[model samples]
Target: MAQQGPTAPVPVPKAGSTPPVSKPVREGIDLVVNDKLYRHTGDKTMPLLWYLRDELRLTGAKYGCDQGDCGFCTVLVEGKAVASCTTKMEKLAGKRVTTVEGLADGQGKLHPVQQAWIDEDATMCGYCQPGQLMAAVDLLSRQKNPSDADIDKIGNLCRCGSYGRIRKAIKRAAATMKDAKA
Candidate 1:
């Protein structure tokens, strides 16, 4: 016969104590993107960038640094610029998300920021323009006449070193929007 060893005692429920009940599992998340409603039932932890690019096929928000440091994945969540790479599906329930594709009007009119970018030749590679445009949209929505410091706070990087042109484009867009309002 083999030698027996001491076994640890198993936890037993006390008298009148009931088993712990598990939390109810979440069914899904619902959100609106580009004015269209979306019901997401997959992993709740999925990043908004992946949902937009992979599931929705809205690839305007580019994947730069997945760490959320670069603003390349920036998008408008409730009209506020957010880093989509770090925003999770679980947090966007019933929220409105807007990608660069949604910036154009139904009549095919380009957004002021987009037109300004073209007019100013603000892009070199054009990889970071989507994020820059979204950020600029949010900024302009808040600040009618943004100064150099305000434009600099857009926080999107252009590897093409088009900062000067980008600043000019934002200024142009701001002016155009102001004119449209008046």
Candidate 2:
């Protein structure tokens, strides 16, 4: 038998070599994202975290544990705290979604909760502070007089063990908000 030369393998197309040909499926999701009215097209199953972080570029919500054990994905939805990582965007249709960006004032000033965090030097790694501030704001909005237990129940975690500082900032922010209302 004659010796056969080694044949080269055929090249495979790259995973994303071609632009997506399919039309982007459109579904209407009317919600207020970051204080702006938005109409988004995404599957009802799409997680709220992707809508906020990827679509809107609101990167404040950290990915942490997607299972909701870690409070890093916390955000305010309809003035209540929620775990955005596990929340479905479709469920939030016609609702208000408030991320860290929405907490700022018209002049681009930080919310009292965020300002207090900075003043108290609350964050260490800072990965978890966004959620912490969001949760604190939600708590304060409901319970203007949150006790230690009320604050503790919100489950804001800082791996840096800045819980003490966080509590103090929340108290200061509550007082400030109250004073402003007065």
Candidate 3:
């Protein structure tokens, strides 16, 4: 009897058949995302918002509108506030990116801004509090005494119409920060 050869596996297309296009290999880069070292395996175009929320599990920055119109995804890059939803992870190389998680002290005590929000009962639904607190931290870091107009210009919004309380919280935080400095 003749020796039988092994049969080759058949390649079959599904109901809708389309040839796969060959995509170029993406250049991998090391990112110190949210103060922790990480090697991102995705394309350079991957936004920092998804990386923080999805990959690193840092969910403080909410994804409200994928577009930059909403400030829910705000985060600190090199101590300056930037929207993480549109910020690319590749741009954060060697820079200290601070999220709401980094706002607290090593003992896990809430930052003054965070405590002020609690004290003033600022957060309603609390979806936007992280971004609000981050923006407030940036504002107070630059100007210890930010005017009402300055607070308004920072672009912190609350859908629950907690604007009054938010303003009060910011003011209280500023006072608290000033007293601490004194």
Candidate 4:
């Protein structure tokens, strides 16, 4: 062993002994998705999209640009629209996550936004519709009467270029939701 300097390294903790205090210990994580609790024990850095699609089978959040540029994996994390592709699972521990599948009522009644989509036939390929619906749901929750600028802020890109129909559906859904509320 080398000679110990005046400023030596801290000794390792003995067996069963607690180590020096530092940052919190990393451990298992619990995530709430669509009112369901999921326990994660592997790498905490896994992106939420993989967990939702691969593990939970909630595949509505499509796999698009995985770098957060594409909104195909958009979902609501605590009522805020988030890009699930780049959202780390560690950050979602104990957070409420709502996907497109969870937007409907427990009685199987579709949300007004979903109904609007069907009525307007806004889906073409239907791949990006899930993300669009999620974004629109979040938007409508915040603004009952969303303007064109509000729609633009959703940032969800539809490859089918169905922006016109989507805009119309949003308006229709807003009206229906308002009527239901009253």
Candidate 5:
């Protein structure tokens, strides 16, 4: 049997030589979603929409119009609607993020806005409805009696041309919420 020679000593780079490349350090963030605390660790520069959809599996926030023109990725950050497609994770630390999934009560009860959306049948292809509903919820919270211009200011484009239905739904939701408060 041939004798195997001792393995040559592994080459070690001198102290001044280039150090081995290390993996990029991951960052951690604390996010409150649907009144729940969630810890996330990953690239801080990633889009919030991607983080919500890919990591947390909250797929309600769509990825349409990643350029920020369309409101397909709309989400409520601390009760204000923001486009998640361009929102970086670093900007959302310790912030409350509300997607379509978070709009309802914890008991799986539909929010008045969601109920009105269903009643009004505001969805067409339904691709943009999540963002539309998110934006509507934020808007109604501030403006219980929103004007046509106010509805237009939501800036959520419906390629399926459900704008009329969306406006009606917002009005219906406002009425329902107002009635509930009374």
Candidate 6:
């Protein structure tokens, strides 16, 4: 073994030392939910539904389909109806979100749409009612005295086939809201 070359020393791990685990860097995200300001510093990829249900404990918006097609997780974001399941937290900065629980007044007076839902007996299983009500609220906010075609555009599905009743309730709620404004 003539002329041995110098070998680089290998770094050895210390005993009882654990490797550092990397956590996702959380950024401050701000939004208003149901007239309350919320500041979240968690995974930015989390959907609004998870923030509402798991973090905020506002469960009125049911989890029917994780995909946006179902409309079961519909909520109002910045006064527009949106599928909460598909709305990521990163997109909600400085936005206002309204859930089904926010439909009632501070004095416990039911929103016209909620009352109409009850008066028209629109619920069969009641699982889809929250999403339906939120969609109706957003629709009525934009369109006054919506036509049958417009009502059909709400797009929230009821497994119980309560379309007729839902339509009637929307009409009634629109009338009630209009009268209240006048």
Instruction: Highest TM-score: give the candidate number.
Output: 1
- For model 3, residues 52-99, the per-residue Cα lDDT tens digits are 777677899999888876789999988888899999877876466789
Worst window of 10 by summed lDDT in candidate 5: 3-12
lDDT per residue, candidate 6, 94-169, as tens digits? 7889999998997989999999999999989998899999999999999989998998988888999999999999
The sequence of per-residue lDDT tens digits that candidate 4 reaches over residues 1-182 is 55322221234344487556587644667666777655666668989898887777788999988898879999999998999999998898768899999999979899999999999999999989999999999899899999888898888888989999999999999999999999
Clashing pairs in 4: none
Task: TM-score for candidate 5, please give it.
Answer: 0.83
Residues 84-171, candidate 1: write the lDDT tens digits. 9999999999788989999999698999999999999998999999999999999999999999899887778888989999999999
Clashes of 6: 0
Model 1, TM vs. native: 0.85
Better of 1 and 3 by TM-score: 1
- Scored by lDDT, model 6 comes in at 0.86
Clashing pairs in 2: none
Query: Model 4 — which ten-residue stretch has the worst lDDT?
Result: 3-12
Q: Count clashes in each candidate, considering only residues at least 3 apart in sequence or on different chains.
A: 0, 0, 0, 0, 0, 0
All candidates: TM-score: 0.85, 0.83, 0.81, 0.83, 0.83, 0.84
Q: Candidate 3, overall lDDT? A: 0.80
Full ranking by lDDT: 1, 6, 5, 4, 2, 3
* Model 5 accuracy (lDDT, Cα): 0.85
- Model 3, poorest ten-residue lDDT window? 4-13
Error of 4 at 62 (Å): 0.6
The model with the greater TM-score, 1 or 6, is 1
